[model samples]
Target: MPEYLVAIRSGRFDLAALKNLNTQRKDQISPLISVRGTSLQDFDNFVDDWGDRLFYLDISRQPKDLKEPRQQPDKPQKINILLERDLNNPKNAYENKRSFYSEQLEKNKNIVPVVSWRANDPIRDIARCAILLNKGGEQAIGVRIPIGKNGEPSNHSKEALSTILNSLPTPEKCVLIFDYQHISSFPSTDEDSWIFKTLSLAQNDYNIERAFLLSTSFPKERPDNGSSMITACLDWEWQATLRNSFEILGYGDYATSDPDGEMDFIPGMPTIPYAGYFSDSHLIWWTKKEGKDKEFSKYIGIAKEIVRLDYFHDDDFCWATIKYEEIASLGGGDKSGYGNNGVWLGFRINQHVAAMLNLANVNDSQIDEEIDLF
Candidate 1:
């Protein structure tokens, strides 16, 4: 039932090949707009002209005999496949997470970036990360709701989510990323069934278009089927049956020892950012929770060098990881990053806010941004 914009790569094969493919497909493909010798500019223009109506042709790069039915009669069964676990690569990580629910939330115009942190109790874990309601473009309204002693949503959180969703022109939108293991004790009903029940409530109550599960320890720690779940967090078991909730788990990016402690400047002096050794620093990857270490400060500090260019870099910009711990240590002598671990770094210096000038290098433009942490 799908039409296609069948691209005829004359440079590689003949036009008759596609006709053979159409024959095999029984003409399910239609209105094939042929393309050849088109430059990137021309292709863009053509795409703009076609807009949403244009569909892609699923052409195979493998050799085709074009003589008989594409499906071999002798080998009717598709080969057993083993999918690769390469989604953790920084370049493709965003895509891997986003594709999970692109179809369901196709109409919503904006997304609310959420970072759910693990906590000592149900209240603290829910209070771990911030809720960033996207304000049109590069700007966002950030809200960190403090959890009450009884683990209730603070007035601040209610106002933020309410005010944003009520005002938005969209019918459904919001990407709540729970960066922790679980919201253990929020509901007094039962221990094992709290997460699903709570999430089901959120789906019916709010305009949450989609949600990405960055991490959850329930399945791996308690696999009833005696199977490994941590290795594939996006499995069907972790998903809930909430009507409005389209949830997908992310690759284990934030599995770590420490969560919220800050790094101390040992002999500790902050350094300026530079160009060398940090050429690909525009994108930050935090698949683990160990970024407050001595080497972490050094590497990230160097990567945050100033670029005075007059444009934003969303195409290849920010990808921060929130986990079970803190971003930097705040205690006097603790570089261990667990000041009650809801200590998230997204509250501090994200890609939105460029690197601050190190007091050590106020006027040095080209020096290495190195630092020693306690």
Candidate 2:
């Protein structure tokens, strides 16, 4: 007698239901995250100073799901996890989806620990539409801070998350995109030295599929919370490649489901406040994969190793191409008061054209139709 559902996602990527499903798709190379304002003419017009690179990103865009009219589910919004199935078959569909996520973490004591779809993909959706937010506005108070069960930090959600990141509003204008040879293990700066020549590391692996990331805010000037990237507090391997691919969007705080506060992200052992914390500019959807999708090149190599990076990637976004979940029951979540790196953005290809398309036979990376992607 198993049958339960209340999934209100749209956590990200729904460009008006993929432009009312037309097809012939292309243009997915948006990786950003800067946290504060960067001067020097915002670094040579980073991607023509973003927005309407033709109209695809629509200036500071974010705030969709506002196109009402009805019936727009052209299929693609799935999530199935049965890591070895059977929870005593009473029609056990992964024990009624883990008892409806343990009754929404026992009726939400302020929700946070959600990600159980243990890989081996069993079907994750999102195509002509479904994912709705990303960089969208209004979502702070640390996302809904409450998390306890040992992942501590509920001093009344740390005094209402320090009064909502100290009366917020001052953390926008982000645009980061890396891959200079698989992040050449970040760490080498000469005082942000013009991002070491406009954002360093590029022995020419096609320079991470270039699109835009100009500097002035990162170390080169340091102001937006003085971040220079490479987090996990400094280099806990960049906090397991950004808290394991963070995706529980809108940005941060929801500690417990296993919180282990003060930093215990654990996928590869993260324990924080090392030497990083910054956010804003979160929009990952950059495809190039032709190397026959070796499972999205092992899920962005488990997203630069941020201890299994969660908040969203662990929810396994673009799940083989799309279908992300746990967006806080869909009211949208994770962008909690920005900081903790919400763990940087994603997808920035060109590791030498993905290792020469896995050894020769290349020719896949195109789509510069004067730029215009959403």
Candidate 3:
């Protein structure tokens, strides 16, 4: 099992962060790539670029607003047509349909399909899991159990898990992901106990091979001011708490992005010139109103401020820090571009992953200090 399971939406920046990781870092992480809407194509491209790497693939429930109205056959008929298609034949008639995702899974040995135990439609989820397991080995499946509002497993999660597991073979070999998404603060003792109980159930009942706790404290709303720090010690503290009780659980979180995931920028709205850097337990941000200066100059300013911060990791810290220094040193009059929001997000996520990996070697005292701060 990998040391860390990082969850990231299948966006250009998120994928780029993973792809840009150094070899040693890449080897330590197993990304849980969540694909939604047309971003499925982006995930496919990432797979092509990254080559063979063990990672989890979750086809997120597409938002209703984002769904394009396309003429398609009924669900059952579509499934039958897809299952009947020639697996070996490269040119299948349903290539343009939703079966494209399943086909991608069939061809990619390294990609593990993640079936959410909190799914609204357990039947459809079960069928999807069955198809993927039948094509891609049964060993390559992950059951994601999301935490509900009361900080415990969702009501339907256990029932859904039982149904899905009974339909598949070698359920014990399947990985388990317990996702406690978007915690506003460190988990209380009661919440921790609830999580521990759920994990114990998984271990005693399912005898699963591995399990991971996933979460994030990144703010859902954007910062209201020019520069501020957001304490992101919630996930770390929760993991530490759980590890004290349940020693076998692995670590995972939504890297840099908020737990709600990425959002598209409005075309007409003005966007602030901003940069975010992930330190040990905080997200240090610098921002300025748009039109205050040239875009490159604003970024350079932010970079300079970031590098000078007390918590700033130097240029050798990671690939992102190197780029930060490069931007910091550029002349204001230079015509070179500093890239857009996507590029900036890539930098934050890349550094965030490196910081998370470094957390493993951190002293217990230092971790306590981090948890106590803010």
Taking the candidates one at a time, how many backbone clashes does each contain? 15, 39, 0
Badly placed stretches (over 4 Å) of model 1 are: 1-152, 179-198, 205-207, 213-253, 265-374
The local lDDT score (0 to 100) that residue 345 gets in candidate 1 is 28
Best by lDDT: 3
TM-score, per-candidate, Cα-based: 0.25, 0.17, 0.81
For model 1, give the RMSD to the true fold: 26.0
Superposition TM-score, candidate 3 onto the true structure: 0.81
Please report, as a residue range, the 10-residue window in candidate 2 with the lowest summed lDDT. Answer: 125-134
Higher-scoring candidate on lDDT, 1 or 2 = 1
lDDT of 2: 0.22
Ranking by TM-score: 3, 1, 2
Question: Mind sharing the TM-score for model 1?
Answer: 0.25
Model 1, residue 86: what's the lDDT? 19
lDDT of 1: 0.27
Clashes of 1: 15
lDDT of 1 by residue, 1-374 (tens): 22111222221112222222313232332212212221224333433433344222111111121112224468764321111211111223223223322321242222222222112223222222111223332322222232333334455544544454455444244333333323222222233453454445446665454433322222122222212111222211233222124342211111221122122222444322111111112211111222332333322322222222212233223222121112222333544443221222221122212121111123334433232111
